[model samples]
Target: MTFLAISGSARRASTTTALLRALQSAATPAHTITVFDRVGELPIFSPDRELPSPPDSVAELANAIADADGLIVASPEYIRAIPGGLKNAIDWLLSCDALIDTPIVLAHASHRGDDMLGQLRLVLGTVSTRFNEAMFLRVPLMKKTPEEIARLLSKDASQTELLDFLTRFAAYCGSAD
Candidate 1:
């Protein structure tokens, strides 16, 4: 199975991005994880702007979503909300002729307990995207030391809670079909 990660944090090595990569690495060997890093380039939703020809970036994103079996969204809380760029990516997806039936897992990271995760869940719920079991944790991973973070990203990540969540999600995807 191919799992796609839609990242809202565009930074090359943001905390949320690093955690997501860790989760993907922790998943069962039967699954393949693909991170979609083009969210920042997708044009904002505008029928007129894209009528003649949709942006190549948008099409590339759509194709990635189309090809995935399941999706994981890891967003950062900006002003206690999901960023407009991520929202626009989802909005542009709604205009596409194809439907994204892949099961979605919503996740977010914040210094405080922010609403980014809840907001993402609402957006996905409203769009008819299947909200499979999701995992949400704060930045720095709560009491984990730098050494622990490094260990979690390595081959032993499966023993961590984040990996446990992905293992559950992977099972859900297999049975949901």
Candidate 2:
């Protein structure tokens, strides 16, 4: 199975990215996980630009999501809501059909981002029919380095939870076949 993981933060060293990296490492050899940490690079979404030809970055993001068997998103909460960059990326997909039935799992790396998570869930549920509310994972990884986070994920308990989530998502994706 192929999983596409996206990090919503644009910082050089963000907990969101660290969590996604740890997820990438935790995946079994039988699965491939690709992390896309370029939410900052995507152009601001506009319906006008959607008509003729979307930007390369937008097109690339859409194509990547379309090709992946499943998607995982790790986003940091900003002001009790999803960050602008990540929300912008989702907005770009609104005019397209790439996310119609794509299976998605959401992860948040904050101790208190339930509000943002809820908003994300509502938005994703509205946009994608296959958004799995049951596959959500929340780990308070703030202030931890990527290596530390990866080591934590290597622990038996953490690994089990993550693997179980991935396994369930993989099964959900397979059901689409």
Candidate 3:
């Protein structure tokens, strides 16, 4: 089974990225997990300019999503909402009719008053994507240290919960599930 773990945060090594890593640890080595952290490469969603042809990077990203058996997306709240970069990627993916109704497992890293998951759901829902389990990281003292945040994101129960969720999806190529 192939699972594409998308880090909604474009940063190199963020809490959101770490969360994705921990999720991968629960999966068998054969599971094909690709992380898309290059939101910066996706151009803005301009219907007119993108009509005749999509940008090269946008096309590639869409193709990848369509081929994946399932998707694990971790979106961090920015400015009390979903970041524009992730929204842009979603917009491009929606243009691909073949990828609609794909199973999406959503995760979020939120501290303060942030409801980015709601917006992400709205975006994916509009495109007819089927949502799976939703995970949230909202520990009280994660601000104190990385170890604390890592522990919360990599908790044993959480990993098992995620693994069980992914197992229910369609056969992932070579996936032990």
**Which residue pairs in candidate 3 have backbone atoms (N, alpha carbon, C) closer than 3 angstroms, thus clashing?**
1-172, 1-173, 1-175, 2-172
For candidate 1, lDDT tens digit of each residue in 42-136?
76789886677678888887788788877788777778888888888888887774335667776554455357667777877777447754444
* Tens-place lDDT digits, model 3, residues 28-96: 665657777888778898887577778889888877887887777777778878788888887777775
The model with the greatest TM-score is 2
What lDDT score is found at residue 54 in candidate 1?
72
User: Considering summed lDDT, which 10 consecutive residues are worst modelled in model 3?
Assistant: 135-144
True-structure RMSD for candidate 3: 4.1
Model 3 bad stretches (over 4 Å): 111-114, 133-158, 169-177
TM-score of each: 0.81, 0.94, 0.78
State residue 127's C-alpha deviation in candidate 1, in Å.
0.9
Relative to the true structure, candidate 2 reaches a TM of 0.94
Per-model lDDT: 0.70, 0.86, 0.67
Candidate 1 weakest lDDT stretch, 10 residues? 134-143
Tens digit of lDDT per residue, candidate 2, span 1-177?
999999989999998888787778778997788999999998888888897878889889899998899899888889989999999999998777778888887988889888889999999989999888877788888888778877787799998887887787788889963
Q: Which portions of model 1 miss their true places by more than 4 Å?
A: 97-100, 111-113, 133-148, 155-159
